[model samples]
Target: MAKKKKKDAYIDPQQRELRELIELKKMQQAAAEHPEEVQAEFEKEEPIVPKTFKEKWKNYWYHYKGLTWGGLAGVVLVVWLIKDIFFGPEYDLSVTTATKYMFSALNDSMSSDLASYAEDYNGDGKTDVTYNEITIYLDPEAENVDVQMNAINLQKLMAVFAGGEDLLFVLEQESYDYVCGGKEGIFIDLSALYPDIDIIEGDKLILNDTALGKKMYLNGLEEDVFLCVRDMGGSVKEDDESLSTMERSLDFVENILREEYPDKFPAEEAPADNSSEEAR
Candidate 1:
């Protein structure tokens, strides 16, 4: 007999069908028993919902719109208030008033009879002031001449105005005395005219003693009174009488300058000239 044929290792089709049928039956029974539990577990889970770009933007705007708009409005209001306070018409008026008073006092102090005569020395009905004995042209473009005079008079007249017996005593005693010593500087007693004036160096309205005399001669006064006072040095006491003398001297110089060089006198620029010119 030929060796018995080896049996195939693969399962028969009938057995495979039986196994599949048995698994199917077991799965159905398990599902029937746990249906309520499965339903409850699915119900406990939350569903996912995606957000759109538009919806996100709407949420952001709702949260921040009031804050953004309020901040912007606050900034604008604050800026407007600052401009109104500092750059408005009221501020301009205040400046104009201060300038007017300053110039008025200066004009009064310098307008002496001697000054007038010097101005009309040529008798041409036109004033011609001389600087350094040389005539300087007065033009509309010139800076304020009064301020120059104030500077010159302060230096030249300090001793005549501030030096006296009382001042000498104070100096001897090594005390810083500020008594007027019966003297009057050019700017003395004229406080009403220039309320804003200060005796500080480099100030536009204030003048040092040396600077006062120098400025006067430079502007066209022929008098050298200030030079004589300067030669005395700053040894004099600040007395009322000395101060008065200084004022008189300054007045005299101012008169001479105005008469001889009226063109150099500081006057307000006529408004008409500025009306048509371009703003600087």
Candidate 2:
């Protein structure tokens, strides 16, 4: 009790009232000096509504430009895909190759040589031939042993097959055997398509020694390579369009086989053979 009385002896009631009064005076001075700020604090905010289409659009874009542009881009992409896939004419020929020797899609050498045989099948007044390559390192010593790339190539190959029945395939002998060597129906027998030509053995069209092959100058093709056409006789996807396309493809193949090169090849057939055996 004596300690409590001693603590209260130092307490100042006047000091506590003075401190409160000082704070109240400071707030009054702030309100007096900055009345607009005080008024703004109590002001009711108005929701702005645009009166015209232009103003509305501007305001809407200001708030949702990202979504608007993104949606527009998505719509354009969808429209393009729809037009390209369904309505667009298929390439005069689509080839899926499982060898390392085929030309890149960008390189027009092989396609150009092959194009000489293409018959404007789509009536587009131009011959369109496209090549899709599957990266299969059949060689044991190949260093590019990427598993992800292998999967992607496999997926691409399956998509090719799924897209149509009348297509071309350029493949290695081992890979050919893995696909449809013993099987007769899966791959069209080239003998039937190019019966008059001699370079074909069953489904294999010996691409070498042909005019097209000579033009291609398939170098680094260390192993036996062949060109094959997918058989559409038993294909479930065969439709009227595919049937017509296959007829044109057969004609194209026949033309390529019929193409001839002279024994004493023209010296100008190529810029003097600066190519070594690897580039032959």
Candidate 3:
């Protein structure tokens, strides 16, 4: 059988189909006599049909499903990260204290009480402030020191300093100047924030003297507890939330410095008169 020469010119679909069908039927009839030769001819004349997108995609996924799924997961993770970074709840202020005990112990009472002092800076429909407590009593270089514990304490303190997010610090008076801001101090001068009231140093507030200190039992402690802000009386540069925290810290300080103190903290009350009881 003679084969038709290949041509570049297009043919009508119906005519092309009819012609191909006739050729196939003829080859099928002749295949009984010369099976191998007819099969070769049929293979040579088979049309090159383009695969549809759906069929191509199926084949592609079969070979590279792992790569495709991994890429999709990466894309989803990136999107989620972007959303969290751009629109996430930030702490209104941070209280970092280097004390014998952790602040988490009183977190519930503190959070409930302090919630009334601050506005929702993060706009999360609730007030929030982080409470961090670290331990570092003796100097790391002191004689007979627990090197490993001191090292851990130093590591935590260094981390806190490097983070720079702690708005306020509650530290022992002796450690205040050395740990925080040297002689001048890194704290915002409360005198400027509250010109009327005479507090500790211009920046420092002696917690032992305040109602807050009484509530925390600071008076009984051997070391005097001092509260100070990181802001340098407008001399220091502000980070992203520094100013916001400064504003909130001032409000919180004002609440703490209120003459009557926050009502939530149990106040020292006079015992009831026994005169009426004696009369009875």
The number of the candidate with the highest TM-score is 2
Tens-digit lDDT track for model 2 on 74-140? 9999999999899976678765678655456535666566667777877778887775667665556
The order of the candidates by TM-score, greatest first, is: 2, 3, 1
Worst window of 10 by summed lDDT in candidate 3:
1-10
Which tens-of-lDDT digit does each residue in 157-205 have in candidate 1?
3432344311111010001112224433412233342233232211022
Looking at model 3, the pairs that clash are none
Predicted candidate 3 versus true structure: per-residue lDDT over 1-280, tens digit per residue: 1233334235578888999999998877888888898678878996844499888888888889999999999999999999867975566776777765454564446655445546677787778766666766555455765678867986897677666666678887645754665546467788776665555568877787676666566677776787887763433446656676677777777767764344433555899999998999
Judge candidate 1 at residue 226 and give its lDDT: 16
Which candidate would rank higher by TM-score, 1 or 3? 3
Could you tell me the lDDT of residue 19 within candidate 3?
Answer: 92
**How high is the CA lDDT of each candidate model?**
0.37, 0.71, 0.69
